[model samples]
Target chain A: MVRYKAIIAYDGTNFNGFQRQSTGRTVQEEVEKTITKMANQRVEIHGSGRTDAGVHALGQVIHFDFPYERPLEKMRFGLDTQTPDDVAVKSVEIVADDFHSRYLVKEKIYEFRVDIGKPRSPFRRFYASYFPYAVDVAKIERALPDFLGTHDFTSFCATGSSVEDKTRTIYEANVTVNEAGDELVFTFRGDGFLYKMIRIMVGTLLKIGNDRMPADSIPAIIAGKDRNLAGPTAHPEGLYLKEVRY
Target chain B: MVRYKAIIAYDGTNFNGFQRQSTGRTVQEEVEKTITKMANQRVEIHGSGRTDAGVHALGQVIHFDFPYERPLEKMRFGLDTQTPDDVAVKSVEIVADDFHSRYLVKEKIYEFRVDIGKPRSPFRRFYASYFPYAVDVAKIERALPDFLGTHDFTSFCATGSSVEDKTRTIYEANVTVNEAGDELVFTFRGDGFLYKMIRIMVGTLLKIGNDRMPADSIPAIIAGKDRNLAGPTAHPEGLYLKEVRY
Candidate 1:
């Protein structure tokens, strides 16, 4: 048996996210089917993490074991030949048998794009969240320092999550406005995230950015330990899993 | 009646084309409906040019006459309120009665993007054309200078065109590759174009760029006045009307 690691990039617009499901198409199923066809055997893939539907990825990491022995170049070529156009294996390499994508991951980064324009462009509808309202950039910038450290993040997590621990360390959190002054990008890097935590943090920050909430209220929201204390969850379309660090 | 000129933009993925058709929705009908609803009277819109199905526009020029009078700001707001999210009237201004979008246009610019990769990206599938082979950019650049002046370009035009004059001045033609080396953008600015002219030009350029045709053969192809001399028309999804100048 040979263990292989691959870096993937995909547009999750039509996918049911990364996990396999019987009812719909998924990124994992698509790659697995292609691999099975090439290897003439069933293959199970282990991904670094799961992404919600309509969320895109640039450098998602995954590992799989193939029955046939092959060089990294052959494996890369075979996967490219079998995989569909939407998903591409950017790179492949041989890894130790003990290597695991999930357990070995050190950190992950996600970016959310918001199109804050009165008239949204059709070209951007699938890639950005359109909010036709005013937002104060200074206010949003002032609130970023509050989310940099370790926190329970219970209030920011979605309700009914199965995860037991909500505490996560955020390495960085920043909000930037594009030069066009019509778009904003919110980026976060962290060790781990609870269900829908990033989206909720974005919403809460948007409210504060628009002056609907005070920057000082971030601590109170985090301390509330209730999902209702945070703002609404942003759309999945605007979120992208940008990178996974080892 | 007051004449109003407006700048429009749309993602053409959802519409049949710029012109109205009985089989499916068109951008023209959508804009006309919105104008009628806002003015409380039917209005006729004349676009500077027509784009085929699956093509997009960033700054398309259009003209319409309305009996009702309103401030430019108010009319723009009202039309935006009633128009679909995909199609937007970016700006509206009262123009001289004789200002015709099509006849008064001095130049039009179109952009075509091609992605050169084995595995296509799903997010960019709707926005770019994918070519799996490597292209010789030097050959394409060498062939482009031959097409920069006024000439009979019937050979570069697709068949079934209704226009009688095949002569038009090409103000500029440039091909710049993205830094990633996986994408190329072809930009053309000209007095006007015959039906599918830009598409055919792109196809022929790709042939030269890919070394399928010799760079020196471009002038001969244009002078031949035969569609067979040119390459196949490219896909419409990769084409965009970048702007219209009047």
Candidate 2:
């Protein structure tokens, strides 16, 4: 068998999530179904990680083993044509047998988009989180650097996350505004992230930007290791898995 | 009674069309329902024009009568809150008793978006038409001026349009690329448009851009007055009713 690695992009609006379940449509189920049909056999695929419902992805990675060899371009074309419109197989390549989509990940980059425009745009309702209230972008920018380096992110993680070790290394963190100056994009590059950690961080940063919370509270929040010390989790719609680096 | 004129925007992915009908959900139905609920009485609204299914709107004008006068801001807020998430009430104002949304329209601007990026973006699938083949934007730009000025646009009109007068004034026609250079937006401003006229014109222009048709064939097509001579109508998803002016 030959192992293949592929990068995929998906609009998660209509999906339950990236993981497969008995009910509800999912990205994994759709991709597997398409690939299995194309291969004329049952095939399972492995993903780098799971993204929650309503969260989009631009470079989600996955790997699968095929029974026989085929041209990479032909395989890519076949997968692209067979997959659902909401899911796109961007590129495919042969990979080493030892390559693991999940365990071998080195870094990850995520993006969260916020629409700061008034009278929220209908076209962006599904793709961006609307924040009509006043926000200080400069203050948010000043606070972004605090998220870099290693920290025990228990306060930022979702309450139900069962992982014991909450420490993760954030290599880079920054915020940028689009050319129109109506939207804010927060980008985070990290060794790993806890459940809903990025969303909670964004939520806290937005609160700081709005002056509801102190701008310099990240250190205390991380040291406290209590979820209640952090702000509420942001909406899922604005979050995107931008890249999974190996 | 007080007359109110409102500018509305909607994501038409889930809507049947702009006009109210007995069957599927429509923009008019949603807006009327929200107003009727707030007024505690049935309210009928007149729109500037109708847009087909899957066609979005950024500045659709509508006028309706209410039993009493309320603060314009309050009415706008109520409509914004009560309407579905995919619909937004941009602004509301009190208009003259004789003012009519449809009859007083002096101009209209429509936009058609084309996705020229390879491997179509999943996020833009519902908003832009994907053309993976080669297209020359310069050719499209060169062909745009031919659509300007007054002309009998019979060839650009759809086959089923019953309007006898096929003449219309085109004040401006241009094609612009976005900052990302992955999208081509075709903007057309005219006195009025017939059914599917903008879409047909965009379809023809895209054909010219792709070298499938002669770049200077627009004049002959307009003089022909035959729908068969024009290119196929573009997809409805890429078309937007950008503005209705008075």
Candidate 3:
């Protein structure tokens, strides 16, 4: 058997989530079923992590083992064509047998897009979160530096998370507007992220930008380690798993 | 009664078309239904023209008569809130009693987008038509000039169109790649267009770009006035009714 590593992209609007479950459609189930059908046997695939429903991905990593050897190009083409239109296998390559998609030291980048236009555009309703209220971009910019270092992100995590250690190192955090001037894009790069941590951070930053919360509250929010002190979780539609680097 | 002119935009992915019909859901039906509900009476709206199913619009104009006079802002807000998420009313204004949405139009601008990238992107499936074949943009640019000025375009018009004249003046025709360099955007500004005319023109231009047809065949195709002489009609997902001017 040969181990293969692949990078994939998916539009998560119709999916329940990245993980397979007993009910509802999922990216994992769709991919595994397609690969299994091609292999003529049951095959399991492993993802770097699970992304919630309505969250898109530009470069998610996965690995699986195949019973027979085939050209990497043929495997990529076969996987891309057999799977549904929403999921695409971008690239595939042979990998070491010890390579694990879920483990090994790595970094991740995520992006959140918000439409700041006055009247919500119908074309962008599914791809971006609508925020018509007034917001000061400078305020959000000033507060982003506080999130650039290693810290316990307990206050930014959702309640359902069971992980005991909430500490993670953020390598980069920044916000920028597209050329159209109608969207605010927030990007975060980190060694790891807790459940819904990026969304909570975006929600808090939006509040600060809108003046609903103080601009200098990030340090205190992290030190407080209270989930309630942070802002509400942002909508999942605007979130994207941009890249995973190993 | 007062006449209200409104600019509307719709995603068109879920709608049957812009015109009202007895069958599937349409943008006109959704807007008229929402406005009638607000007025508490039966109402009808007139559109600039009909757009086929799966064709989006950014500036579709419509006019309707209302029994009561309400603030334009309030009416716009009401229509926007009541209509389905796929439709949005961009602006509303009171027009003269004799103003008509269809007859008074002086110009129209349409845009067609083609994704020339490899391995079609999942995020753009609904918004753009993917063409993975090799094509030369300069060949397309050379052929675009022939489409300008007044000409008989029966060869470019789809067969379902009943319009007899088939003659239209083209004020502007151009093609440009987006900043990402992955999409080719074709823009055509003209007095009017017949059924699927823009799509047919794009299809023909793509053939010329791909070297499947002579780059200089547009003039002969126009003179032939035979629909079979033109290339296949492009996909409707890439076509958009950009604007209608009075």
* Pairs of colliding residues, candidate 1: none
Q: Write model 3 residue lDDT over B12-101, tens digit each, in one string.
A: 899999998899999888898998988899999999999989999999999999998999889898898789989989999999999999
Indicate the docking level reached by candidate 2.
medium
- lDDT tens digits by residue: candidate 3, A1-246: 889999999999999989998988999999999999999999999999999999999988999999988998899999998999999899999999999888964899999999897568888897888887898999999999999999999999998799999999999999999887889999999998999999999999999999999999999999999999999899999999999988
Interface RMSD of predicted model 2:
1.1
**Model 2 Cα shift for residue B145 (angstroms):** 0.9
Tens digits of per-residue lDDT for model 2, B55-129: 999999999999889998899988998899889998999999999999999999999999987578888898998
Interface RMSD of each: 2.4, 1.1, 1.0
Best candidate per TM-score, number?
3
Count clashing pairs, candidate 1.
0
Segments in model 1 whose C-alpha atoms lie over 4 Å from true places: A70-74, A77-84
Ranking by DockQ: 3, 2, 1
Cα misplacement distance, residue B72 of candidate 1 (Å): 3.1
How does each model score on TM-score?
Answer: 0.92, 0.97, 0.98
